[model samples]
Target chain A: MIKIDQLSKVFQTSNQSIQAVDHIDLQINKGEIFGMIGYSGAGKSTFIRLINRLEEPSAGSVLIDDQDITKLSKRDLRISRQEIGMIFQHFNLLWSRTVRENIAFPLEIAGLSKTERSERVDQLIQLVGLTGREDAYPAQLSGGQKQRVGIARALANNPKVLLCDEATSALDPETTDSILSLLVDINEKLGLTIILITHEMHVIQKICHNVAVMEDGRIVEQGSVLDVFSHPKQPVTKKFVEQVMGKPDNEVADDIFIQQVNSGKVLKLQFIGESTNQAFISQVAKKYDVELNILQGNIKQTQAGAYGSLYIQVTGTDEVVSQAIAYMDSTSIEVEVVAND
Target chain B: MTDLFPNVDWPDLMIATGETFYMTIVALIGALILGLLLGLLLYLTSPGGLWQNKYIHIITATFVNVFRAIPFAILIFLLFPVTIFLFGTFRGTTPAIPALIVGTAPFYGRLVEIALREIDKGVVEAAQAMGAKTSTIIFKVLLKESIPALVSGLTVTSIALVGYTAIAGMIGAGGLGDYAYFYGFTRRNFDIVFVCTVLIVIIVFIFQFIGDWMTKRLDKR
Candidate 1:
């Protein structure tokens, strides 16, 4: 478990001090994929680095599994460093060494014997699905292959906590999906707690159990994937969700719904969590004797469950319309009245 | 065929060749070691470098600039007293060691600085993220990864050292340059000067060739 308490980082430039990470506190549980999503320069990277002591926090303590690593000596810190592995967007593999040797670098530094180091290197090379490329150099490999080497190298010592610094940012979309799946596989098989930092919400929605949205060095919102996706409180979080789910324009949706429901009352519905079941949408319409016309609708599945948003027109009398919306509210679905056309 | 070269002694030519080889080899090794360490220091202590001492950088930079600006020939004459005191005479290859090392150390120091600067900063940050201490990052990552570039830089600087050795030879240090200056310049032995010039060219080409091969071999990344 990683706990950050009132952490802040201020870098003093020649002219003025810049607050890279403002006062923030967070707790990341063990064996879970925790994501920090934000735009560029939102202090997500700084927060992650603070957990690993890569960037010293100007204030507060970083407690990893009960040890306050912030105050440790440099020597002791190095020993602690062996436990937390990190991968980067650029891969950053040593160009001078072969993939095998690159993976074995940290193990060698930790004083593993040559035979032990080679065995560990081979194991990681297999784990990352680069078993045949161990002898190749970073220069000889493609971008995805190099990042695989980086992942393999980071896992050389079998760290419990893996920090991914925009690990998929440099890969193509197809490659990004493959890598994300690999990370998910590793997280499940080894129960390694992953702290993922990225600006892409799809990355979070795909694998993250919990996510935090950050802006200007502060976390604006955080919760389970379902909570943030179903009800985004912050504009930044809303924008991020729309980027992934492609929210239809409010004006267009309203006009189209008005046209469809010109004869009867209509309502906009938001289905979250367990309410994503088809039974709720279909059963409600059949029971009320109302024809359902979906104007704009989208459903996204997350770690928690499926969440959906839809504006549906229903040909029902005023009393039936009120009853239909009232019945839907008892479930996890939220029903709101659209203006009569 | 022997008329223009009748005064040439084959044994003396062989001895002069050996002298030039010794002078250039010894000075090149010393200069490389000195310059590489100095360069590492300059890199590690620059702004945002590992240690990050602006004062140390200024002082070191001033010393390097001072030495680098000095003409090698004039510096050799100026060091005559110390050369004599150190070697018991201001003549021969032994006296030339001080001048040669002094002249080449700063030159190679500056070269090593440039080579080290050319390395990507991302590599350094990656090492740091892994919890590598400063020393490990330098010797293990920076120096090891940059070996190919460093080797090439050394090759260029060492070839320049060969030229320095000739200047040392001009100052009574027995080598190809001494033979050329004495037997060819004073005695007007055009054949001896031509042979010495050819030897210098061949030695430089050989060093340059080895340097290039080593660089290529190590540049597999």
Candidate 2:
């Protein structure tokens, strides 16, 4: 478990001081994939680095497995860092070293014997699916393959925590999917506590059990994947959630829904998990005598479960439409009145 | 043929050529070691560097700049006293070693600094992230990554050293340049001067060819 308490980092320049990270506190349980999502320069990178002590914190402490990492002596810090492995977006593998050698680096640093180091490297190479490319240099590999080497190198020491710094930001869409899957596989097989920082909502939707949305050095919102996706309180979080759900222009959606129905109401219905499979919309329409026209819908299976968003135009007497919305709300679905006359 | 080249003393020319090679090789080895150490210091002390120190960086940088600005021809004459004090005599090829090193070490030091700077910052950060100590990062990451570029820099410094070794001839240092200046120019022996110039060009081409080949072999990027 990693617990960060009131952690902060401030950069003091000659002309001005920049608060790269405010006093933020967070806890990541063991064997869980926690994601921090934010735009560029939003302090997510600094927060992750603080956890590993890559960037010294200006305030607060990071406790890993009950040990105060911030207070560790220089010698102890070096030894403790062996347990925290990190991978980079650029796949910072040594261009001069082969895949086998790159994977053996941490082991060598830890003073492992030659035979043990080689054995560990072979296992990591197999684990990361780089068996045949063991002798290839980083330059010879594609972006995806390079990341695989990065993963293999990071895992060579069997670290308890793995920090991925925009690990897929440099890859193409197809390659990104493959790497994400690989991360998921590793998370399950080894139960490694993984903390990944990214700007893409899809990355969080795909693998993160919990996520934190950061804006301007502060966590604006954070919760489980289902909770945040189903109900985003912050605008930044809402924008990110909508991005993956194929956001429709609110004005256009309102105009189109209003044009279709001269009165009544237009509502957006959110269905998640088991509720998505249920015929909630049709049931509400039938029970309340409201005619429902579905304008747009998007549903995807997230790490939590099935999640969906639907825009519907409910046309009937105001009393009946209100009754229908109330009925929908009584069920597990979330109902919001977007447009009404 | 004998009449055309009457002033060409084969033994003296050969001896001068051998001394030139000895002085150039010894001085180059010393300069390379000093330059590499100073260069590493310069890089590690620069702002945002691994072991950044403002004061050390300024002092080292200023020293490198001052030395780099001095012309090799004048530098030899300026070092005459130090050379005599160190070697007990400032006249022969042996006394030229200090001047040759003083001239070329800073040149190579600057080249080393440039070569080290070319390494990606990400690579260094990755090493540090792995809990590598500063020394390990310097040798294993910084120096290892910049080998090809360093070799190319070494080649350039060496060629420059060859040029300086010739300039040492102005202070009674024996070499092809000394033979050319004293025998060929003073006695009007154009054949000797022409032969010495051709030998210097050949040596430089050889260094260039070897350096390029080594760099190509070492560079995987």
Candidate 1 lDDT at B53 equals: 96
Q: Report, in order, each candidate's fnat.
A: 0.60, 0.65
In angstroms, how far off is A129's CA in candidate 2?
1.0
* TM-score of predicted chain A against the true chain A, for each candidate: 0.86, 0.84
Give the Cα lDDT of each candidate.
Answer: 0.85, 0.87
TM values, all candidates: 0.90, 0.89
**How many collisions per candidate?**
0, 0
Clashing pairs in 1: none
lDDT digits (tens) for residues B66-125 of candidate 2: 888999888887987898789988888888988888788888888889999999998888
**Candidate 2 pairs with clashing backbones:** none
lDDT at position A250, candidate 1:
62
Highest TM-score scorer: 1
Give the residue spans of candidate 1 off by over 4 A: A248-252, A255-271, A274-296, A310-341, B1-7
